[model samples]
Target: MLMLRRTKNFLNAHGVEYEKEHVNPLMVPERVYVLKFGKRDGEFLNRFIVEHSYTWTGRDKINKITLRLHGQKHPREFANEAKLLQYLEKHADRYVKKQGNKKAGKNS
Candidate 1:
């Protein structure tokens, strides 16, 4: 919960738009943050989701932030908020919607 709050605060402070959603309502019940940045031909060019997870068995596990990027086979886990924020800031980009007729703008 604390990790998620901190992530949300970072996103808000950075002016990064994101969506909050549950990973699985019935089974997982974990909430995740989805963010889309940059665009190509009106399609999202970069996308990623952040999730928080922990375990309660044996020694108590510390909360970690998981970042899953599109087209990646595995997700990257981060324990430091600054590093995660730095990564997100580096990848985040402003999306400008293309103007005028799409097909006519292309070369013959």
Candidate 2:
């Protein structure tokens, strides 16, 4: 929970816009958040969604983070918060650039 809170704070402080949605609660109480970019003209801009699930009590207690990116069939799972943050920081700019180029191509 602490790691998730820190990640949310970091995104807020960096002025990043993201949408959070709750995944199936009956099965697993997981939260899925996606970083959004580009113009919305009724077209879906493919991006990555981060899904995390954690529990504090019981033997089933677990803290897990997974990232599902564009053009990738399999999701990349992170064992810890540091690695997840590092991955986000490294690829976020690239996605922004790609989105800009996509918009530019449409204008041309």
Candidate 3:
């Protein structure tokens, strides 16, 4: 896996906007089998929904989760994250508006 700094640099170079979600390195599973057997995938997916879904209001408009499984060959998790990102990117306008509405409601 690549170092976090390297990942950040790569994303920056590619013009990808991202937020880093700090996590406990020791708690992160290094293998796909462990993630699947330990039920981390389910938890991650749920967290992803909560973070990305524009159902909540406030300053937390975008919820970016940075995983430490950099070199891990977890194709499933990667695919899931990619799918979510694609969905968000495809309907970015709607999602942004939804987030705006959420903030407006909070302000009022």
Candidate 4:
């Protein structure tokens, strides 16, 4: 599966809401993007970002997929999987409401 799809599936399975931002390299003309999750999933998002490496070769290859978990402290430590899940669980209601709003907006 493509990276974006995999990432989206991962978030959906965990009941997290996310937005994707695509960044194209200017010099190499390659496709690269950053997937950013909302503050509700900040902890898990941090872990995902930390575990992945971001590097580019000759600007031609899409080097890295940057995962930005919103509302995290600048330069925060990587959160553990269990902690991330706990955070998500705690905020489940808020996430559900947000998702509902998103769906409603799309319909309109």
Find the candidate with the highest TM-score and give its number. Answer: 2
Worst 10 residues of 2 by lDDT: 95-104
Residue by residue across 1-108, what tens digits does model 2's lDDT show?
Answer: 233556666666655555554444466576555544332454334443555554464323325566655456887877766787788788666443233334445557
Q: Give the TM-score of candidate 1.
A: 0.42
lDDT, candidate 3, 1-108, per-residue tens:
222344345335544444334233355333121111112323322122122313335222333433333234442233334544555456445312123234445557
Stretches off by above 4 angstroms in model 1 are 1-3, 9-16, 22-62, 94-108
lDDT scores of the candidates, listed in order: 0.54, 0.55, 0.33, 0.46
How many backbone clashes does every candidate have?
Answer: 0, 0, 1, 0
TM-score of 3: 0.24
Candidate ordering by TM-score (highest first): 2, 1, 4, 3
TM-score of each: 0.42, 0.51, 0.24, 0.38
In candidate 3, position 5 carries an lDDT of 42
Comparison by lDDT, 1 against 4, better one: 1
**RMSD vs true structure, all candidates:** 8.1, 6.7, 16.1, 10.6
Compared with the true structure, what per-residue lDDT tens digits does model 1 show for residues 1-108?
A: 343556566656655455554453456634455555444455554444555444555332335566765466787877766777677667554323343456654567
Q: Judged by lDDT against the true structure, how good is candidate 1?
A: 0.54
Runs of candidate 3 with Cα error greater than 4 angstroms are 1-18, 31-82, 97-108
Report the C-alpha displacement of residue 44, candidate 1, in angstroms: 8.9
